[model samples]
Every structure is written in C-alpha cells, then in structure tokens.
Target: MFAFIISRLLQALPVMLTVALLSFAMFAYVGDPVAIMLGQDYTIAQRDQLVADLGLDQPFFVQFMKFVVNAAQGEFGLSYRLSRPVAQLIVERAPATLELALCAAILALAVGVPMGVYTGLYRNSWLSRFFLTFSLIGVSLPTFLIGILLILTFSVWLGWLPSFGRGDTVNIGGWSTGLLTWSGLKALILPSITLGLFQLTLIMRLVRAEMMEVLRTDYIKFARARGLTNRAVHFGHALKNTLVPVITITGLQLGAIIAFAIVTETVFQWPGMGLLFIQSVAVADIPVMSAYLLLIALMFVTINLIVDLLYYAVDPRLRIGRGKGAH
Candidate 1:
C-alpha cells in the first residue's frame, strides 16, 4: 500500500507540474496586471519598478521557475484585484466551497443510492418509473437554471430559504463553517440541491445500471440457487458488487462537484472559491487565477489517487490479484 501510494504520488508530480506550467503560461500574458494594479496615475518609472518587482522583466522560464518554487511554498504572490495574498483569499473562501461540495456529495449519495437500489430491484414499479423520470429532469436541466428555479420557488415564492450567501458562520480556529448555525443550514439547502442534482441523477442511473447488471450475473443465480432469501441475495451479495463501480463514479463526481460548482455558485451568489474565481476573472487577477487552477488540479489528482486506493477496499478481487502478483 505504501509503495502504491508512493507510485501514485510520483505519477501525480508530472501532472501537477504540467498543470502549473500551463496555468502560469496562460495567465502570465492575459492582461496588464501592472496597469490594473498601479492605475492611470502611475509614472513610467513606477511602472518599470512595478514590473521589475513582479519579475515581469525576467525571462519567461525564469519567471515560471520562480512561480513554481513560490507555489511550492504556498505563495502565489499578491492578487492584483483584491490586493491580498492569493493563498489567504483561497483559505478564507475554501471552507465555503468545501462545505458546499461536502453537502452536495452527501445529498447525492444519501438520496441517489437508495433510489437506485429501489429502481434496480423493482424495475417495473410505478415508483421506479417516477424516479427515472425525475432523474431525467435532474440530468437535463442546466445547473444555473436549476439554481435559479430553486431560488425562485424556495427563496422568492415560498419564502422558506435564503437566496444567497454562506449565511452565518462560526470560526473554529480559523476554519469558518456554517454547519453550526440554523440559518447556515437553511441557506445550504437550495445551493446544495442545485449543485448535487446532476450528480445525484448520474449516480442513481449508474448504480441502477450496475445493480441490474450485477443481479443478472451467474454468481447471483448461484446465491439464489443456494436458497438464500431475496433480501440477502439482493442486498448482501448484489449490492456489494454493485458498489464497486459506484465508488469509482462517486469519487470522480465529488471532484467534479468542487471543480464545476462555478455555475451554481454564480447563480446563488455563494461566497465560495468558484465565486471568488469568477470575481477575479473580471480584472484578470493572475495570481488568484493561477492559484485556483493549481488548486483544482491538485484536488483532482488527490481525488483520483483516493479513488484508486478505494478500489482495493471495495473490490476484494483487486487485493487478491495484487497478492497473487506479489507471490
């Protein structure tokens, strides 16, 4: 397991470097951060000094190497727009994005898995058909549209939930969280649902399909032939196997939730990293943009590594295969 982890980390190194290089290259020339930062009143000498201070006058590779080294130490310089350290801004906004993503992932798994199980087990049932139809809506609608519709229904029309913001939060050792407050929880509902809806449908459909496929396998027939109860054969045997693929999809979808929460965040005006990134883009905040890019890439790599590790836990066959190969 240690070797596997080390190997995965080694694999991730190049990917991270590639992402860092690409992000730096792309954002480096996007706009005149000097002009944006110094404003119209600055003299040419001041501009030159600013450019020198920012290392803009250096060779491209030199600047890129500096960026990589700085980034390694969790420094992305200063945000041109916000005039704050990019890392600090990310730290402040990260909790909101992570919290929102966590809630969305929970909603997707909690609701999707059961719905999928029921649909797979009772494929001909009216409830199963209804779930299928509902899933279609969840899958078909765009995230922003869903968020807006939800805001209209729940926030505007029903007046049950707040439309925007992270609501009230309590800072615990510099980690701000809304989970402790009633208003915070309420505020989370619509955005969480909107962000998770597509993932929920995707998970449900994947689970249902996997479940159905697993149920038809010869092992399932053998289990039934052994006079196992329907519940035992279905849940104990088939569901366990069904979850192998579900775990993989769920892991990837969780990463997707964080990466693609931009649309939902925009619609709901959630004060998460996605919203921050959007705000930064208007002025071409390179530090924030590059940092966001690197962070997202890191998250994806980490999630993929975790998912690979989980395969050994979920599917014993992987462990057995590894053991055999070792021997």
Candidate 2:
C-alpha cells in the first residue's frame, strides 16, 4: 500500500508541473492583466516599467521557473485586480466551495444509493421505472439550468430560501464555513441540490448496474436459497459487494463536482472558488487563474490519494496484497 501510494504521488508530479506550465503559457495569449488594469491610465514607459517589474518581459522559461518555485512555497503572488495575495484569496474562499461540494456529495449518497438499490432489486416495477425516469432527467439536465429552476421555484415564487450569497458563517481554524449555521444550511440547500444533481443520477445508475450484477453472483443466490430475507440478501450482502466499484466512481465524481461547481456557483453567486475563478478569468488575472488551476489539480491528486488509501480498508484482497508486497 505504501509503495502503491508512493507510485501514485510520483505519477502526479509531472501532471502537476504540466498543468502549471500550461496555465502560465495560456495566460500569455489571454490578454494582459496589466494592460487591462492600466486601461489608458498609464504612459508607454510606465507600461514598460510595469511589465518589467512583473517579470513579464523575461523569457517564458525564466518566468515559468520563477512561478514554479513560488508556487511550490504557496506564494501565488499578488492579484493585479485585488492587490492581494492570490493564495490568501483562494484559502479564504475555498471553504465555501468545499462546504458546497461536501453537502452535495452527502445528499447524493443519501438519495442515490437507496434509490439505486430499490430500482436494481425490482427492475421491472412501476416504482423503479419512475425513479429511473427521474434519474434520467437528473442526468440530462444541465447544472446551471437546474440552479435557475430551483431559484425560481424555491426562492422567487415560494420565498422560502435566499437566492444568493453564503447566508451565515463560522470560522474554525482560520477556515470559515456556512454549513454549520441554520441560515447558512438553508442557503446551502438550493446550490447543493443543483451541484449534486448529476452526481446523484450518475451514482444511481452505477449502483443499479453494480447491484444487478452482484445479485446474480453465486453467493447472493446461495444466500437467497438459504432462506435469508430479501432485505438481508439484497442490502446486507449484495449492497456490500456492490460498494467497491461504487466507491471508486463516487470518489472520481467528487472531483468532477468540484470542477463543475463553477457554473452552479456562478448562477447562485455562492462565493466559492468557482465564482472566484470566473471573476479572475474575466479580468485576465493570471496569478489567480494559474493558482486556481494548480489548486484544483492538487485537489484531484489529494482526493485520488485518499481514495487509494481507502481501498485497503474496503477490500480484504487489496489489504492482503499490500501485506504480501510489504515483505
């Protein structure tokens, strides 16, 4: 397990470097932040001085090397637009995105798993068909559209929830989260639902497929022949076996949710990394944009590492292999 973990981490190193370098190079063609910031307010010499000061006049390789060194130490430089540390901005706002992602993931698992199990257990039932249809809709509809519809229904027409902003927050260990507060949770509901819709559908389908396959296996058939209750046979045995692949899909989906939440956050003004990323892109804030890309890459790497570690706990075979490999 340790060797496997080390291998995965080692593999991620080049990918991270490539992502950072690509982000840096891409910004060169995305229009200049300095030019946008100055906006006819500065002379040619002043512009040149600003460019030189920012090291933009340096060779691309030289700039990339500087960026890589600084980024390794978590110094993402100052945002041209905000005049603040880009890393600090990301740190402050990351919790909101994390909160949204986590809430959405929990909601997806709670709803999707059981629904999938039921559908898989009774594939031809009318109720199963109904849920399958709903899952189809959930998968088919785009996230921003869902967010708008939710806001229109729950906030605009009903006036039950706020349509925008992180409503209330509490700081813990320098990280502020709105998930813990009543008002914040209420505010969280719409966006979380919007962000989680696709994941919920995806999980439902995966579970249903895995459960159906597991049900046909020898152990499940034997369990049923041994007079075990349908509930115990399905839930206790089949579901447990179905979870290994489900876990892998769920972990990958989580990373995807964070990546795609940018749209949902923008629609709802959720004040998370997505919203911040959009705002940064609009102004050609290279520092923030590059940092955001790198941060997201790091997040994907970290989540995959955690998921890999969890495999040992979930499956005895992997654990046994690890033990043998250690020798």
Candidate 3:
C-alpha cells in the first residue's frame, strides 16, 4: 500500500511539471504580464524598471526555473493586483471552495445512489422510467442555467433561501466556515443543489445500470434462492457490488465539482476559488491565475490518486493482482 501510494505520487510529479510549464508558457507567450502590471501611462524607463523588478526582463527558461523552484517551496510570489502573497489568498479562499465541493459531493451521493439502486431494481416500473427521463434532462441542461433556475425558484420567487455569499461564518483556527451556521447552511443549499443535480442524475443512471447488471448475476439469484430478504439481497449484495464504479465516478465528479465550480460560483456569487479566479483574470493577475491553475491540477491529481487507492480497498482482486505484479 505504501509502495503504491509512493508510485502514484511519483507519477504525479511530471504531470504537475508539464501543467506548470504549459501554464507559464501560455502566460508568457499570450500576454505581456509586465505591460498588464504597468498601465499605458508608464514611461519606457519606468516600464524597464518594473520589468527588471519583476524579473520579466530575464530569459524565459531562467524565469521558469526560478518560478518552479519558488513554487516547489510553496512560494507562488505576490498577486500583481492585490499585492498579497498568492498562497495566502488561496488559503483564505480555498476553504469555501472545499466546503462547497464537499457539500455538493455528499448531496449527489446521498440522493443519487439510492435513487439509482431503486430505479435499477425496478427498471420497468413507472417511477423508474419517470426518474430516468428527468435524469436525461439533468444531464442535458447547462450548469449555469441550473444555478440560475434554482436561484429564481428558491431564492427569488419562493424566498426560502439567500441568493448569494457564504453567509454567517464562524472562525475556527484562522479558518472561516459557513457549514456550522444556520445562515451558512441555508446559503449553501441552492448552490449545492445546482452543482449536484447533474452529478446526481449521472450517479443515478450509472448505479441503475450497474444494479441491473449485477441483479442478473448468479450470486444474486443464489442469494434470492437462499431466501434472503429482498432488501438484503438487493441492497446488501447487489448495491455493495455496484459501489466500486459508483465511487470511481463520484470521485471523478467531485474533482469536476471543484474545477467547474467557476460557473456555479459566478452565478451564485459564492466566494470560492472560482470567483477569486474570475476576479483575478479580469485584471490580468497572472500570479493568481497561474497559482489557481497549478493548484487545481494538483487537486485533480490528488483526487485521482485517492480514487486509485479506494479501488484497492473495495476490490480484493486489485490488491492481489497488484501484489503479484509487484513480485
């Protein structure tokens, strides 16, 4: 297990390096970070001074190496716009994004898995068919549109929830979280639902399909023949077997929840990394944008690694096969 984890972490390094290099190249080639830093009012001498100060006048490779070294040490430099350390800014805002992502993932699993199992178990039933139809709709609609629709329905018309912001956070050890507060949970509901709906439908469909397949297997039939209760046969045996794929998909989607929260955050005005990223981009804050990209890529890599580990836990065959392969 330790070896596997080490290997996964090792494998992630080159991918992260490539991502950082490409992102830096994009910033360097596509736009002038120095000009963006100094407005048109700045004289040539002033611009030269600014460029020298920022090391923008250095060779591309040299600059990249310096940036890479600094990044390795957790120093992403200061934000050109806010004039604050990029790491500090991310730290302050990341918890909100993490909180939102976690809420959405939990919501998706809590609702999606059961509905999927039920629909799969009763594939021919009216309720199953109805859910399947709407699940398609959930997949088809855009995330931003869903967020807006949720806002309109729940916040504007019904007035049951707040429209935007994290709301009523409590400070715990330099971290402000809305999860513990009533106002925070209320503010959380609409955005979480909006973010999770597609994932819910996706999980439902996958679970339903997997369940249908598993139910037709010989083990399930034998369990049924052994006079096991329907609930035990279905939920205990079949649903448990179906969870491997469901977990894999759920992990992948959880990554997407964080990566693609840009739209949802924008629509709902949630003060997560996504919104911060948008605000940074508007003013050409290259440090923040680059840091955001690198951090998000690293996040995806970490989630995938965690999912790979989970595959070993849930499926003994994986552990045995890996053990044999290791020899």
Candidate 4:
C-alpha cells in the first residue's frame, strides 16, 4: 500500500507539470492580461509599467517556473482584483465551499442509495419504475436550471427558503444556537440539493444496476435458502456485495462534484472557489486561477487514489491479475 501511494505521488509530478504548462500557455496565448489589468484608462507606457510590475515582460518559461515554485511554497501570488494574497483569500473562502460540497455529497448518498436499493430489490415493479424515472429527470436537468427552479419554487413562490448566500451576514460563523441551526440548515438545503442532483442520479443508476446483478448471484440465493429474512438477504448479503462498485461510483462522483461546482456556484451565488475562478479569468489572475485549478485536480486525484487503496482492501481478488482469473 505504501509503495502504491509513493508510486502515485511520483506519477503526479508530471501530470501536475503538464497541467501547469497547459494552463500557462492557454492563458498567455488567449488574452492581453496586462491590458485587462490596466483597464481602459492606461496609455501604452502605463501598460508597459503594469506588465513589467507584474513580471509579464519576463520570458514565459521563467514566469511559469517562478509561479510554480511560489505556488508550491503556498504563495499563490497576489490577486489582481482583491490586492490580497491569493492563498489567503482561498483559505478564507475554502470552508464555505468545502461545507457546501460535503453537504451535497451527503445529500447524494442519503437520497440516491436508498432509492437505488428500493429499485434494485423490487426490480421491474412500480416502485422501481418510479425511482428510475425520477433519477432520469434528475440526471437530464442542468444544474443551473435546477437551481433557478428551486429558487423560484421554494423561495419566491412557496417563500420557504432564502434566495441566496450562505446564511445571515452577521453570523456567518457565529450561529450555533437552536433556532439558528435550523435557519442555517434550511438555507443550505436548496443549494446542496441543486449541487447534488446529477451525482445522485448517477449513483442511483450505479447502485441499482450493481444490486440487481448481486441479487442474481448464487451466494444471494444461498442466503435466501438458509431462511434469512428478505431484508437481511437484500441489504446484508446483496447490498454488501454491491458496495465495492458503489464506493467506486461514489469516489468518481466526488471528483464530479467539484467539477460541477463551477456551474452550481454561479447559479446560487455561493462564495466558493468556482466563483473566484470565474472572476479571476475575466482579468487573468493567473496565480489565483492556477492555484484553484491545481487544488481541484489534486482533490480529484487524491480521492481516486484513496478509492484505489480502499478497493484493494475491500476485495482482495482485485489484486490478482486477469490472466490468473482466466486460468
């Protein structure tokens, strides 16, 4: 296990380097970042000063190396718009995004897995068909559209929830009492649901399919023949066997949650890295944007790595070669 992780770390170096190179080349080739920074008022001389000050006049290679090195040291340079340390800004805002993302993941698991279990257990029955149809609708809708619809229905029409933001501005972090807890949870519900819709749909389909297969296996029949209850035969034997694949789907979707976060953030006015990423692009805050990208990619790769390790632990047969299995 240790060797596997060390190998992954070594492989990650080149992947990350490629990401940096591509991001730098694309940003530099596509836009006049310095002029954007200068805005409309600056003359050619002023633009030159702005470019030089930001070290844009340096060779591209030198600039990229410098940026990469500084980013590794946790200095993501200064934000052009905020005039603050990019790392500091991200650190301050990270929790809000993390909280939102975690909530969405939980929501996906809670709703998706149970529905999937029901569908799988019932097979072609009305309950299964209803859940399958619901999952399809969830998957088909765009997240932004879903978010807006949620806002309209729950906030404007029903007047049950707030339209946007994390919660009350005054107690963004301080609210922990009974009433406030409910308020905070209420505010988060719609956004979390909006963020999780696609993932939930995907998980539902995966779980249902895997469980259907598991139920057909001889071991499940053996468990049933042993006079086990229907619930035990399904949830214990069948669902447990299905979990390895379910975990894989869940881990893969963890990466997707972050990817989808961009759209969801914009829709709900969530003060997450996704919004920061968008704002940075308009003016070309390279360091901030690159750092955000790198961090997200790391989250994705790291989750998959953890899943790989977990899979090995979950089923020892995974370690055996396919050639060995064929024999």
Candidate 5:
C-alpha cells in the first residue's frame, strides 16, 4: 500500500508540473499586471521599477522556474487586483468552497444512492418512475439555470432560504465555517442542492445501472439458489458490488463539484473560490487564476489517487489479485 501510494504520488508529480506550466504560461501573457497595479498615474520609471521588482524583465524560463519554486512553497506572489498574497486569499476563501462542496457531496450521496437502489430494485414502481423523471430533469438543466430556479423558488417566492452569501460563520483556528449557525445552514440549502443536483442524478443513474447489472450476474443467481432472503441477496451481494463503481464516480464527482462550482457560485453569489476566480478573470488576475487551476488539478489528481486506493477496499478481488501476483 505504501509503494502504491508512492507510485501514485510519482505519477501525480508530472501532472502537477504540466498543469503548473500551462497555468503559468497561459496567465503570464494575459494582461499587464504593472498597469493594473500601478494605475494610470504611474511614471515610466515607476513602471520599470515595478516590472523589475516583479521579475517581469527576467527571461521567460527564469520567471517560470521562479513561479514553480514559489508555488511549491505555497506562494503565488501578490494578487494584482486585491493587492494581497494569492495564497492568503485562497486560504480565506477555501473554507467556504470546501464547505459548500462537502455539503453538496453528502447531499448527492445521501439522496442518490437510495433512490438508485429503490429504482433498481423496483424498476416499474411509480416512485421509481418519478425518481427517473426527476433525474432526467436534474441531468437536463444547466447548473446556473438550476441555481437561479432554486433561488427563485426557495429564496424569492418561498422566502424560506437566503439567496446569496455564506451567511454567519464561526472561525475555528482561522477556518471559517457556516455549519454551526442556523442562518448558515439555511443559506447552504439552495446552493448546495443546485450544485449537487446534476451529480445526484448522475450518481443515481450510475448506481441504478450498476445495481441492475450486478443483480443479473451468475453469482447473484447462485446466492438466490442457496435460498438466501431477497434482502440478503440484493443488499448484501448486489449493492456491495454496485458500490465499487459508484465509489469511483463519487470520488471523481467530488472533485468536479469543487472545480465546476463556478456557475452555481456565480448564480447564487456564493463567496467561495469559484466566485473569486470569476472576479479575478474580469481583471486578468494571473496569480489567482493560475493558483486556482493548479489547485484544481492537484485536487483531481488527489481524488483519482484516492479512488484507486478505494478499489482495494471495496473490491476484495483487487486485493486477492495483488496477493496472488505477490506470491
């Protein structure tokens, strides 16, 4: 397991390097940070000094190497727009995005898995049909549209939830969280649902399909032939096997939830990294943009590694195969 983890980390090194190169290269030429930072009143000498200070006058390779080294130490220089350290900004905003993503992921799994199981078990039931239709709607709608619709229905018409913001949060050791407050939890509902809806539907469909497929396998027939109860055969065997693929999808989708929260965050005005990225883009905030992309790539690589590790836990066959190979 240690060797596997080390190998995965080694594989991820190149991916991170590639992403860093692309992000740094792409953003390095997007706009003049000197102009944005210094404003129109600055003299040419001041501009020159600023450029020199920022290492912009250095060779491209020198600048990129500096960026890579600094990034490895969690430094992405100062934000041209905010005039703050990029890493500091990300740290302050990260909790909100991570909290939102966590809530959305939990909601997706909590709702989707059961709906999938029920629909798979009783395909022709009216409730199953309703779930299928609901999933179709969830899958069909765009994220921003869904967020807007949710805001309209829940926030505007119903007045049951807040439309925007992370709401009241408690800071614990510099980690701000909304989970402790009533208003915070209420604020999370609509946006979390909106962000998670598509993932929920996708997970439900994937689980249902996997469940159905697993139920039809010869092992399932053998289990049933042994006079096992329907619950035992279905839940104990089929559901367990069904979850192997579900775990992979769920892991990947968690990463996607964080990466693609931009639309939902924009629609609802959530004060997370996604909203920050969007704001940064309007002014070509290169450090923040590059940092965001690099962070997202790191998350994806980490999630993929986690998913691969989970296969050994969820599917004993993998462990058995590895054990055989070792012998």
Candidate 6:
C-alpha cells in the first residue's frame, strides 16, 4: 500500500506541475491582464511599469519560480482588483463552498444509492421503470437547467425558499444547533438539489450496474441457494463487493463536484470559491484565480491520496497489485 501510494504521488507530481504551468500560461497569454486590470486610461509606459513591478517583464521560468517560493511562505500574492491577500479571500469564503458541496454530496448519496439499488433489484417492475425514467432526465438535463427549474418552481412560484445567498447577514457567523432544524434544512434544499442532480443520476446508474453485476456472481448465487434471504444476497454480499469500484468512482466524482461547484456557485450566486473565482477571472485578477485553481488541484490530490489509502482496508489485492497494475 505504501509503495502503491508513493507511486501514485510520483505520478501526480508531473500532472500537477503541468496543470499549474498551463493554467498560468493561459492566464498570461489569453489576455493583457495588465491592460484589463489597469483599464484604458493607463499609458503604454504605465502598463509596462506595472508589468515590470509584477515581474511580468521577467522570464516565464523566473516568474514561476518566484510564485512557487513565495507561495511556500503562505503568500498567495495580492489580488490586483481586491487589493487583498488571495489566501485570505479564499479562507474567508471556503466555508460556504464547503458547506454547499457537502450538502450536495449527502443529498446525492441519499437519493442515488437507494434509487439504483431498488431499480436494479426490481428489474422490469414499475419501480424500476420509474427510476429508469428519472435517471434519464437527471442525467440528460444540464445542471444549470435544474437550478433554474428549481428556482422557478420553488422560489418564484411556490415562494418556499429564498432564491440567493447563504442567508441574511444576521445568521452569517452564528452557529446554533437549532440552525440545522427545519428552517436551516429548508434553506439548504434548493442548492443541494441543484448541485446534487447530476451526481445522483451518475451514482444511480453506477450503483445499479454494479449491484446487478455483483448479484450474478457465483458467491451471490451460492448465498441465495444456501438459504440466505433475498435481502441478504442483494444488500450484504452484492453491495459489499460493489463498494470497491463504487469507492473509486465516488471519490473521482467528489473531485468533479468541486470543479462543478464553480458553476453551481455562479448560477445560484452562492458565496463560494466558485463565485470568487468568477469575479477574479472577470477582472483578470491572476493571483486569486491561480490560487483558486491550485487549491482545487490540491483538493483532488488530497482526496485521491485518501482514496488510495482506503484500498488497503477494503481489499488486500489493492495493496498486493503494486507493480502488476503499474502504468
């Protein structure tokens, strides 16, 4: 397991470097960030001076090295637009995005696993038909469309929830267990549903297919024949084996959810890294944008590491497959 993890870490190093370098290059070349930041009135010399001050005049390698060294000291650089530390901006806003992503993930798991399990179990039954139709719509429809539809139905027409932001300013920092009560959960419903839609569909299908495949295996058949009840055959034996691949897919999906959170945060005006990232991009605030991307990359790396660690506990084959599975 240790060897496998070390290998995965080694593999990820180059990928992380490439993603960072490519993202930074795109930031540099896609637009005149200085011009975008400084606006039209700034003269050519002024822009040049600003570039030099920001080390834009330096070689690309030099700038990258500087960013790496400075970043090591916990300096993510200043946001040209916000005139604030990029790290601070992200830290301040991390909670909202984290809360939203977690809520969405929970909602997806709650709805998707059961939906898939029952659908696959029943096969051609009415419940199976219902899930099949629902999964099709959930999978086919884009996330933003789901968000809009929810807003129209629940907020606009039904007037059941507030359409924007986390909540009133009064509730911003206060933590009451009661907040998790009805009103708080209600506030979470729309955003959770909107963010969870695609994941739910994805998990439903994955779990269904996995469950069905597991049920057909010799062990499951034997379990059923050995006087094991249908419930035990399906839930215990089948679901256990299904978790291995499900773990891999679910972990990757979580990383994807973080990426997609940017979009959902934008659509709902949810206060999160996504909202901040969009604002930073629009202003060409390189530091904040870069930090946001970096943090996101770190999230993937960290989660993958955790997932890899989980393998040893789940199955010894994962630990034993060290070299034979090497790329």
- For candidate 4, the per-residue lDDT at 192 reads 90
Candidate 6's TM-score: 0.86
Of 2 and 6, the candidate ranking higher by TM-score:
2
lDDT of 5 by residue, 12-35 (tens): 999999999999887677777778
Ranking by TM-score: 1, 5, 3, 2, 6, 4
The residue-by-residue lDDT of candidate 4 on 196-248, one tens digit each, is 98889888999899988999899999998999999899888888888898898
For candidate 2, list the clashing residue pairs, or say none.
Answer: none
How does model 3 fare in lDDT?
A: 0.90
True-vs-predicted CA distance for residue 310, candidate 1, Å: 0.4
Note the residue pairs that clash in candidate 4.
none
- The clash tally of candidate 2 reads 0
Rate residue 38 of model 2 by lDDT.
78
Q: Candidate 5: misplaced stretches above 4 Å? A: 41-48, 324-327
- What lDDT does candidate 4 reach at residue 118? 86
Candidate 6 off by > 4 Å: 30-53, 168-184, 322-327
Decide which is better by TM-score, 1 or 4: 1
User: Candidate 2 versus the native: TM-score?
Assistant: 0.91
Better of 4 and 6 by TM-score: 6
Off-target runs (Cα >4 Å) in candidate 2 are: 27-29, 33-59, 320-322
Tens digit per residue, CA lDDT, model 6, 63-168: 8777767765657877888888988888877777777778888888888998889887889999889888988998899888888888899999999986777763
Q: Which ten residues in a row have the lowest lDDT in candidate 5?
A: 318-327
| TM-score (all chains, Cα) for each model | 0.95, 0.91, 0.93, 0.85, 0.95, 0.86
Q: Return whichever of 1 and 2 wins on TM-score.
A: 1
Residue-wise C-alpha lDDT for candidate 3, range 43-99, written one tens digit per residue:
989988988988888999999988889888878878888999999999999989989
